[model samples]
Target: MSSKRESPLEVFLNRHDDAAWRETLVTLLPAIHEVDRNAAQVWFHFYPLALLRAFQAAEDPARLAQELLMQGSWYLKDQLDASHTFLYGHRFWPEVKRAVVQLAGGVEIPNGRTLAEVVREVARAAAAERKVDESLTIGIAAVGLMALQQVGSEEFRRAPGEVLIDRRHLKRTPEEVLRERAKDEGQGLFGFLRTADRRWTVVWDENADDRRFKALDKQEVASGAQADKRPWHETDARCTVNEGPIPVQCRSASCGTCWVGVLGGADKLSETEWRERKVMPLFGYVETDDPKPLIRLSCQARAEGPVSVVIPPWNGYFGKYLKRVREGTSEEAVASS
Candidate 1:
């Protein structure tokens, strides 16, 4: 049997690099998360089409998977109904998902629209229908587009209509969640004396009520996981693949497996040093000069106060590959000239 052909929207999504998408998403960051814009930005970095495309194009995917230290599910299609769970706008997923399908199905191929335009159009429509803040729908709309790309137009149209989130998760409103994200517990009165051994809470997953670990003052985020002796690997697939609440291979920054997105309390962490600054871009995770950025290697970041972080589903070394591609393109341009 012949394989199915890709849809125009899928082709469009596949054509752009993470930077292009980031440029658009960053502009709407203030609209996506009321309190945790940085964290949401990090979440976008969690999944990259370029990385997924590289994996798909590899000659030996299994071997490449090993080299990349991939864990959990990278393909958004497999979790289409619930992929936006981590985003605050997850509450609007049902409407957003439906809008994505309707938009892709109704539009003609090569409509001359960028992915950024599509995201805004869907978000604006969903907000108008839901009568909620437009900001609430922005992230979900972006997620819906990603789903459409991963599953293709046909599967997207046929995707399940029901919401996949557990009913229990609906107890808190998005506004309440935003308030919680902005919360910061101060050290007790004795803390001012500097005599108490200060400790802080690190929330690995915000959606979970009890998914947290404690870290001592100035303790590395990954190191605190060592104190949690629970059989985490038995429960979380990511933990199963690697070792801690945050999957880490080289605790010394040799491997990019321990990278995470700080949803809150970025300033509470230690400043980004030279070694981490150099390796993050090489790991293809972050490219910034900020001392403390949203994206960070868990092994290198030390907590000074309570923080919330999101671990990516996969990790890899793709900076060299991207650099080579850029050089090749430059050479072609020179020859053409």
Candidate 2:
């Protein structure tokens, strides 16, 4: 009797389960450039599972990251085109092509290489060099290779045979970065009062030198102090870009508009409260017990100290879309049939 075969989506997902994906990311992170790594990390957090469903139904089985890189602008209509920013920035694609070719034993990859092709090459290299079983899935290997190529190796030693999560790349330890920013801002006559109060720095844009905000001790930064009106609160001017700078509405987590990815200071952020915990999954951003995950609703996260964060270029109500997919009622599923 013949056995049932798993679908491409299932096979891909099973090969790169959450734990394995995270492990691979941690391992290859050192090889990726700091800027690219930061951008990729944020992109990883914002990856939409809804798109995965769409791809599955469309019979187009591709790497989730690659799909995002190629077609995310259409699906995430409200987002600021993060894929274009990262993939095209500083000639990133050429570097990835070079890494893929090197891993393929100097064989020239065809121009316009797809994510699956690059991953297959990396998987072959990893299995041969590491002497690991060939059963390792290409999805996991691809993510690892992509990260490795993006984050080029540091000057110390050869790349590890077995990848491990290295926390050293976390750059500015939250506490230190926040403290220095606060000091640099300088408090005058109220310095004594401010000294008594703990302040944290929220680096909203990792790429921008000036895109940062100060949060007073124990105060939720999302609250938007009267003295400093947040960009989201400015209604007088129209934003020229889609997904304009930390676009937010309703300072509370109720709007799901203030989501962000913690790039450097996950530990320094306030623990996830019940409201945020309940609401985040609803936003389809994250569903985990980790008190301070990379994806967070800015309104819900209060800073204990300094943190570097990346604001996702878009936000929307996709919880219902996911629910419909799970229930087999999604329009994509019906249309595909």
Candidate 3:
């Protein structure tokens, strides 16, 4: 009997099943940003799957980073379908074309090709002229090209340039917005309790509108009610409050369970402790010297002012795993298990 052929998506997924691909994708992610106006929307769809794949890869960071640099735009194709799924459901190239056409004001994209193909073409053009660095620019340029195609080249070059989709046309600056929020909250009989100095807002999950927390100054945002205090892996109950629970355990950064991605207000939080800096890399989450980076240990990250953060869906002792990989004992450990 003849065997069935695997679909392109299946083939891509299978190719990345090895640890190397996943690790490389994860290492490259922080540096990857949206290239065009719709880049954020496109990336948002791909991030979860990309992160999941990275976590599953369980490879050594040193090797992963090197692979990412060498692979360049070729690496992005593996996760293209996943990104498309985020916006167009299970539909693939056909749906992507439709969406692109719709966004382009019904202008048909010449040559039937997927978004990834178009991005690769753009990257190649830039590389030909030596106008862009393949290592640093290709990944984001691909994403930007998707957004550009969706918006159309004509509109992208128009006056004031309709490049990115600006949903928030706020009249106030970030500081002004925060100031107004503080003023609005400090109005009731218990207004003193809600003073700017005493309390602040913690947007625990930027994607979830309801995940915002009204927290006290210098309070440990990860701690929950007595009933909900359980190790994050052991139970779903993290820290419980009136707003809802924020994930936690050990309340000390030892477990690596409460790590979060800081979306805004990095400057507002306390500086990273030596322990956090050392441990975060092992977790394969983030490795940077910036005192306040996008990644933070929620248990250790005390809130002093209003801030927004993105909680990863899962966490673990990936640092230890990475150590094993580096030592060449990871395969042995897996085989033994």
The models' CA-based lDDT, in order, is 0.73, 0.50, 0.46
The best-first sequence of candidates by lDDT reads 1, 2, 3
Q: List the residue pairs that clash in candidate 2.
A: 31-151, 31-152, 32-150, 32-151, 32-152, 33-151
> For residues 188-269, could you state the per-residue lDDT of candidate 1 as single tens digits?
6666566257788888777787788888888999998777767777765556343457777778988887888887788888
Q: Is candidate 2 or candidate 3 better by TM-score?
A: 2
lDDT of 2 by residue, 164-220 (tens): 222332233324433543443334566546755657667765444666767786667
**Model 3 local distance difference test score:** 0.46
After superposing candidate 2 on the true structure, give the runs of residues whose Cα lies further than 4 Å from its correct spot: 1-39, 52-93, 97-196, 224-245, 334-337
For all predicted structures, in order, the TM-scores are 0.86, 0.55, 0.48
Residue by residue across 1-337, what tens digits does model 3's lDDT show?
Answer: 0033433322322333224333443444454332221223224322333333343364564454343221111122333332322111111233223323333343334544444444444444444444434333445443433333222334333313121212342122334434432433344688667655576677653323455666667666564222232333332333334323555556776766677666456676788889999988766566679898667887777776667665544455555555575565866347555
Task: Name the lDDT value of residue 78 in candidate 2.
Answer: 27
Model 1 segments more than 4 A misplaced = 1-8, 11-15, 109-114, 158-164, 237-244, 325-337
Put the candidates in TM-score order, highest first: 1, 2, 3
Identify the leading candidate in terms of lDDT. 1
